[model samples]
Target: MNTKKQTGIHTGLPKLLLIALSLLTFTVIMTACANTKSAFPDSEGKIKITATIGMITDVVKQVGGDHVSVVGLMKAGVDPHLYKASQGDISKLDHADIIFYNGLHLEGKMVEILEQMAKKKPVAAVSANIDHSLLRAGDEKMGTEYDPHIWFDVRNWMKATEAIRDVLIEHDPDHAEDYKNNAEAYLKQLEQLHQEITEKIASIPESSRVLVTAHDAFGYFGDAYGIKVMGLQGISTASEAGTKDVTSLRDFLVESKVKAVFIESSVPRKAIDAVIQGAKEKGHELKIGGELFSDAMGEDGTTEGTYIGMVRHNVDTIVHALK
Candidate 1:
């Protein structure tokens, strides 16, 4: 008997565990639904929206406005690529009227739980609103179909705002006008933000407009703003940077005379430091420009916590460091 094939391929222990947990949550969710009355806050007249990441959480807040209550599964500095849903999360999902996520497997492990919840509730991927042709295809490093960091591009992120507005309207037709007005206000702000970024990026000498980070989350940002982007790791931070990747990128920085590379608020600085040290050893001095919000945003209530403010901070940091 070909038990090898029958046993199924083992991707990794982490993946197996994620799958097992996903199944266990299924039963837990069912039991919780049978016993629990209200899984989320104040039983009220608002749409219960649960979002997977801070960026999407911001969209829900902006579009849903006064008519929706939102619960974000992932917090600031939380890496969604490695995030797993807990039992409490399952209860929240079970009670949510609608759920939003970045999709394209950005919430890599929580995907099954989100999809399972979709059988009963509305689960939408705001990233799906972006034009498919505009997406950056993932390479062997990411092992995915397309890159999931659409929030890096302000224009692409606007699509997320629109998607959220539409979803909210569909679910609550009573507030359709409110959702449209709020989204329109946000979109105008985003339009201005995109223009601001384009002009800011253009200010740097064309040769000097390079953005290096811990991972390849800035592909859309670079393509949209016309700057060069490189990362020590791949599209997913789950993949670690190798010795060869460090040395080659170090050589490129040295040869290109790139000024600075930025670390991420969510990612560790070790790999970026290694690349910097490698460049120094090879006769180049590269400074840590500043921390950029890549996968996550800044703390709540801070300017950088909001999407527009986050983009502004990133562009300002980049322009200051590179220029």
Candidate 2:
């Protein structure tokens, strides 16, 4: 036997030792790669940002521009009030350099998870800086907390935009100028949007400004745009609309002779349909004005997906139906 150890790859270490050394080297490389990828500007040279909802994601995308990669956990027509964080969402949150959410209990189910994550990273509520006075008091059924739908009013959204801009600047100062410029441009666009919606809403008669919907997500919109909003469900969709609630809203619709009630994209249509049936029984003809984007925006690529487009679509829908 040519057992002269056939001058092969010779290592003094045992097989087990060789294996351990291989694993160690692999782990070190992996750790180095992970550390490099986790840097503020990721491997793609963009900050990794995660947002709880599409609205916040839109704002971040508008402001972060090319310097950030955003992941929105909530899709169109997903209700934030009832949304729970998934394992994938947790992973995204863990990997994100920063996270943005509407806050003020909008994301009811995920609040605890988000709170816990806040201790470890920059988790910010885009609506955090809004003056408390501007917020509508949440209905008692919805815990009587501050309403989290601050994005309804353009002014409030401006505040949210500012908060987002500030956070982006704080976390990634290298792109501070980009964020500032983008925010300023977006603010101007929002100002224009506000004026446009105001003028369009002005076309609707004051008496017809009643905006009945599936839920009370539009309280801020109503308050800002001079409409009377009523919903079978409370501010949070997590609250069910009882029979009594349906009956009461039906009576209100009949009494006020409100011509149209709206359905929300995120809320189930059953409740609104019940109200419609109840109204029909009372001899009031109520139409489903249109589906409004509440607690969510429209599809991603459509114009309605954008904040400006969503607001405009809502204003136009309200005016077209009620006016």
Candidate 3:
């Protein structure tokens, strides 16, 4: 997770023994070698690339550095689930040197367009989906598919970063080294983030490792950590939380005596509150834990506004609430 300091965009670094020291030295020396900008326009001075959303856009900026000018189609606070491409989006994609989307059918309605664009351009799904074995199937209530919210877990996102870097290197051979170095640097940071998150989550009591949400988006997070996840909605926001599912969840909350249920930043708390309400009906009272950054990051200009910041915020909130 490449943590953003403030303004949701400020972006990280580190090493082994001698190899690590040399890499750090090299990074300090090469700090001024590239720019994280767009990668189009043919003119060495200007390049234009488009990203599907803010998350992918930030990632491109982190890895592409100043070598490319990037455009993000989805505005902050916009739901990617039902986003429709405007004329401007097509134009941006048409002229982009490369494009990145959070695949695994995340952009469900937009997949056809993206595939067509991929035929004539370099495009990637950029999810841990490529590694099918690691993915768990979404429950029948959430539709018959695997959950696409792999980025919810920082460790899973590192795989997507590698995929992004590999594709960028292939398309823009000139900046292969730069892309590789940036991705490597970011990957190390993500590793550290994973450890940090693990330690934080570990600080919570083992009996408190229960994460309930509006949807099943936290499957990967729960999988990575030792938490039992219960969701009122399906894996996708498109699916509504059904009566049976809610009843089952209510039963689980009462049986497990779960302490907290979390609400996603992008989702309404009404649904989660219902779960808590049901628990109270059964003589079990559950806390709201805290608001978490789930499908999307926090409000723009905040620490949790960036991808890394969002994850760190989640880790901190979860640890604090559960512990």
Tens digits of per-residue lDDT for model 1, 137-213: 97665567899999888888899999999888888898899999999999998999999989989999998989999
Give the Cα error of residue 104 in candidate 3, in Å: 0.5
TM-score of each: 0.87, 0.89, 0.81
- For every candidate in turn, the CA RMSD to the true structure comes to 12.2, 4.1, 17.8
lDDT for position 203 in model 1: 98
| lDDT of the candidates, in the order given | 0.88, 0.87, 0.76
lDDT, candidate 2, residue 110?
84
How high a TM-score does candidate 3 get? 0.81
lDDT of 3 by residue, 251-274 (tens): 988988788889886677777888
Measured by TM-score, the strongest candidate is: 2
Question: Which 10 successive residues of model 3 have the least lDDT summed?
Answer: 32-41
